[model samples]
Target: MNMPLELCEARDPKGLYKLARAGKIKGFTGIDDPYEPPINCEIELKQDNGICPTPTLMAGKVVTYLEDKGFLEC
Candidate 1:
């Protein structure tokens, strides 16, 4: 459901609006409704860079966490 703005603008608003009215697509963000909730109103960011541990490390942590929670087979 996430799409870059350039792709959305390329379709032309008038055409996209017509498509929405015709029900060609459902839940079109930035067109049918507000794409995201108010900034900083509902969610909080812990870091500005948004960099977390590497993917492999993250995956390992997830597997470990799931195992600890009794959700993973191994």
Candidate 2:
């Protein structure tokens, strides 16, 4: 008897559709969609700090600010 070395996994289409609808997973190419705000406040505040801030500097500033505000994990 001979067996195939590679097996193709089959996904349940209905389960996938349900998960997408419930927003459990992101579907890059989906039929129905929910609308999120154009800007998230935290990220927007971080980006708006400077137009040409170096990534390292920006990261440091964000870390410092979050630390001062008691938001940083460590």
Superposition TM-score, candidate 1 onto the true structure:
0.32
lDDT of 1 by residue, 1-74 (tens): 13344554654657775676578877776666667855544223222253434447656766776788788785
lDDT of 1: 0.57
lDDT by residue (tens digit), candidate 2, 1-74: 01111110123445665565578767523325533445535533232432444558767877887898899778
For each candidate in turn, the TM-score is 0.32, 0.32
What candidate 1 gets wrong by more than 4 Å, as runs, is 1-51
TM-score of 2: 0.32
Q: lDDT (0-100) at residue 63 of candidate 2?
A: 87
Give residue 8's lDDT in candidate 1 (0 to 100).
49
lDDT of each: 0.57, 0.48
